[model samples]
Target: MDDTGRTPVVDLRLDRAHSARIYDYLLGGRTHFAADREAAGRILAAFPAAGAAARINRDFMARATRRLAHDGMVQFLDIGTGIPTSPNLHEVAQRIRPGARVVYTDNDPIVLTHAAALLRGRPEGRTAYVEADVTRPESVLGAPRLLATLDLTRPVALSLNALLHFIGDDGADRGHAVVEHLKGALAPGSTLTITHATADFTPAAMAEVGAVYARAGTPFRLRTEAEFRRLFDGWEFIGPGVTLSHRWCPDRPGDALRATSAEAACYAAVARKP
Candidate 1:
């Protein structure tokens, strides 16, 4: 916590809790601190299957990216891009198309610190990082790197995976202001991919779980189908609409259904801009 009142991307607050680090730990990454691991363990003690859930979400990301790159012919704007997890959106997209472009944005300084790995994309393609808040869609859109990645006038896939819940409204519109603003910027054929937490199932455990994050200042916002869908008012949901993370084009059998309660409470969806 220096002049920025925060750790340099890598200056992790091991003593405090953080969603990104907790997510890293759950994903079996070694960049987290002991405290992060402990916090994640406590979360697992409650849900008992958080790690697997996180993996499922990551897998959904891969499936969605593959679908986009194979034919979308657009760049990617991956906001809330977590730490340098393998098979990152860019990696998956670039794999399918040698020169796919990706622009990742996150508020975590740790992400900025470890971004060297995130930046190592195919030479023919482009990869860049922007340290900014997802709520500030303007700054994110204005980043020079993002401008360099692709033509904004063309269709783009905006990956807001596990991001919108963290952004809410006080007395604003039904959907967060930023989301509307973001969607306004996308081209007609662009896509919006999302994975959000829900309390549609497992209310008790999910409530307690939400409390844990709130107390740690890493609060959670569990949305309903209608409320979540409102974020994409003009966009058309792809086949299957909004479902659980595991159900979003899952790769393996027995992995294509979303959990509907605290015993299961994650939602995933991909939609196209009309």
Candidate 2:
């Protein structure tokens, strides 16, 4: 254990080829194995901009959280919460709204292993970490431990960031099902913040990236803009709906349109409950 009452979280046998660790490597994180690094390197070699795309996705998370905290009073439910990246959802939200409450969920055992970092929150705010799968929403919301920290009576901002690709697009593995369930459970004024990788901009690179994930046991599936918009069917999308991650309400004007091709591969939008 590394003083967090949890194990050091380095497992090689089960699967050194996990999406979380691969992403960790891409983002210059130190929690990846040689195999994961190799995969990430191959992807980066294919698209030299993959690292920048990862950074843009990370920026999207921060930007979306800023929107939630300043413009809305809703709590947050962040699923597919990856490794403990700095300025995480809770950190961003709580910084803006000191009383903001956040609940994080991730099925990855590695994420669970490092969850201790997620529990840290502003003294005035609330944060809780739950080890659960997005494919099973009931198990998450119904978990007594998490429900205690988050109040379901009001709105909650549900974030699905760079995670949908991991969910198979078939009948049972469909990620839309997970979104439907969570959106169904939220109250009015709630918001859904989603950012997904797409092949609309870079077909060849996207194909190769998908293949890399496939070989690593985490095949990526790109969703079209229309299919992604369906995720917010009932919600009232804020201005600039279903736009590129770099286009979604940047800190200032004129930034979105000039976004690079790599960053544009990811579609990001935030919609509020009507």
Candidate 3:
């Protein structure tokens, strides 16, 4: 702990392969280490469209954020925020609503190192970063920075893109329970947007990809369409409910048609609390 008595940030552990770093590597970011690159290589060999899948997932995030911001939602809570890439959540939200406030949470130390990029926002808006794990919803929900930046009583958009798959079911409803806990905390009209990896389209390829992640010490559980839909159980879906990542409000006219569900390998949805 520093003189402030708060816990110090953990080590980067560049030798270890973290799911976030591997995702960074797949997204063509330079923040990953050799370990992350190696794991991404294996995943690519198993599923050649892994990079495209990552891009599709990212596009889903931008679209969802824009839709929420345009719809007058001014606060955002993004958990499992990976390494900072251009057009971060704040950028997309603030573009539509300059007063939009965003709180990004992630356990990865590398994301903390690059937190500054996530914090640059318009003078009228606010952006904060909280280094916390999604598995411990209380840690994120109760964070001082989060509490200061976002008003829980107000409508906030929560995005969990490409994250829950890492939290494996374990036959105990692990990921689902986390979502439920977070959902219960938000006020009515708050939105929950998620993009999760699934094996429903190509079970063999996704299984091989999961094996690669497991070998890298990351637990990856690819859910089915039914299981993915269960994450947003009681929430009201916004548009094109629980479709393929690229198919969820594609920007271009034929963009969704160009990418097959097997190529995307992920499902995307945005729902609001009743």
Candidate 4:
């Protein structure tokens, strides 16, 4: 609506703190406003390692994408695709397979506003964005742009990194149900990659962090390692099964041991649909 030629379907809401923008602020990006920076300051006071956690989580996404592309998977569907950070999922995959196709879906209007950055993929490859929420898996999978960009009949690498924590369990297993629905829709041999925040490693710090997000009107639920593993039920885990974010198929020597479990505060894994 503000000159992008496409009317904004939702409000930008710069007055409120958004998880995506808070993350951008924590990562030292200039895309955040004062509200986001204020919330980020509270989060850092509660969990000083937040910036490191964000970086390591992003690094995991890159490693997982490269591995999947190297394994010959040519399509990627990244739900909760956040603000388009450099070396995005498509950038990583297309680096390995120039013709790789990627569909990035997110509920954030800011992400939708800057989607052009995400769309800039290699000429041989394709990238598309869907302004949809992850809770509504049908809308994401059935989106016209998503369908046109990637062939669902083929193996696709699906990533839900650092996203599930925002979806409260609500005592009905809603989070797990959402994942199962998405998993069922994918073809056999497709891979599911996830990096989720957990309280298992540092319960007190994570609890404080959760309180901060809650006060900001965002639901935050840090899961246990068992709960995280259950999200991948019925799938075959790849090598180095279910480790800290920095430990999952680390790309460098000593990388796995670099961050303490409490500092990482997140669990990550890659599994095959088989």
Candidate 5:
């Protein structure tokens, strides 16, 4: 609560590597520490294109946010929001619709420490942060801050970019179930956007990368295209359907062509609740 008037729960946990920090490191963010860099190095050894995958996934988030905002969606609920990356979901959405409302939730305390950056949105819009885990969707959806910033009755654009893969199947298809529960809660006409890691293109390399995250005490489950598609079950796809992260509504001429499927290693899509 230093100067931002927000008290951050400071459990730094610099001793072990965190998936969020590793992703921040890969995305060339400075919020990571030494342990994060070491784990990122091991992941890079297994999958050299990890950095590219991270960037491509982030670009997909930006594109999805812009599309949703441009299409007249005003409320955004971004669960598993990572470290404050520039042009964040709120920034992208607010830029398109200044009155857009965004609520970001993440489990990491570091992200809470930097949550101030996420809250800095257009004056016409509203932004809020909730330090909560995605596994417990109830906690996130019922958070006071989230409720205050977003109207549950409105069509909210829910973004789960590069997040679901961390939730292992656990023999019950828990990840998909959680997503379904969340989707059920949103209003009709709401949108669900996701970008998840997949081993379809480079199984061997991705397996090694999964092993690294496993060793780091993180559950890394790379799903297939069919499994990825199931997450959006009962919803209608926006356009182009499910595709590689880089190929999902590319904004620039060479954006989609810049990364191969193996290099991107993630599947992305946007769908409406209808």
Candidate 6:
């Protein structure tokens, strides 16, 4: 690791656009570079509510983490953790359960640079960052930091928020296969939380949005409601079944009213392994 805590061999790759950085740009974060900004602008043009959708997805993660922590879950494994946004998963989980142990995994090296921010949590809580890709479940599940911080035998809260869309279905790295691999590693009672982009609401706009990402060298597959729900097959839903991102376990009355389905453009749910 370098002085910045980033892996020496991991290239920042600022010339090309990365999905995580593009997401950071959409969330109005400063960690994004010019390539990410350019792709985000095109995405906004394709879907005017892109920024709102990103924010709604982020809120769902916080709600899911809080719900899991309140339900007596102390170990968390959050894959595809993007740039360190304030009130991150560890912050929300630790607030509810101060001793919550969180393992954050991401493929982006830029995220590795910002891992320090992700590591800072309440003294009683434990936070670790694993630089790995979700496509190879073993890389994340078997990470040293992850194994040291979380007990896979215990009930864990696994979150994959606004991430699966970047993984296409036709690749050898199939999205469902990867998810199933991770799910199979967890013990029963482990909770899975997901917020995935979908075309169930605005098909044409989402298709255009996908095209924008494709042009930027990123794969974006917007699943339908049925397809998204299938990702949680066999898991018992915690609250309302798969719903719009903003509609899932809304903390405030206005939270559900905050965004329309088309604006949120994402499906969210929390389910437990049965």
Report the lDDT tens digits of candidate 3 across residue range 82-119.
99988899999999999999999988788888888998
Predictions in order: lDDT:
0.79, 0.83, 0.89, 0.89, 0.90, 0.88
Candidate 3 local lDDT, residue 146: 91
Model 5, runs deviating above 4 Å: 1-8
Clashing pairs in 1: 9-109, 9-110, 201-260, 201-261, 201-262, 202-261, 202-262, 244-258, 247-256
What tens-digit string does per-residue lDDT give for candidate 6 at 146-191? 8889999989899999889888767554888888998899999999
The superposed Cα distance between candidate 2 and the true structure at residue 207, in angstroms, equals 1.2
lDDT of 5 by residue, 17-48 (tens): 99889999999999888888998999899899
Worst 10 residues of 2 by lDDT: 1-10
Tell me model 6's lDDT, rounded to 2 decimals: 0.88
- In model 1, the number of clashes is 9
TM-scores for every candidate against the unseen true structure: 0.91, 0.92, 0.96, 0.96, 0.96, 0.95
Off by over 4 Å in 3: 1-9
* lDDT digits (tens) for residues 1-274 of candidate 4: 3222467777878888989999888777878998888889988998999999999999999999988999999999999988989989999999999999999988889988888999999999999988888888998898888888988998889999999889876788777889999999999999999999998877888888888788778889778889899999999998688989999989887998888999999999999999
Q: Where does the lowest 10-residue lDDT sum fall in candidate 6? A: 1-10
lDDT of 3 at 81: 93
- For all candidates, what are the clash counts? 9, 0, 0, 0, 0, 0
Q: For model 3, what is the error of residue 243's alpha carbon versus the real structure, in angstroms, after optimal superposition?
A: 0.3
> Higher lDDT: candidate 2 or 6?
6
Q: Give lDDT: candidate 1, residue 232.
A: 76
Clashing pairs in 4: none
Give the CA lDDT, 0 to 100, for residue 17 in model 1. 74
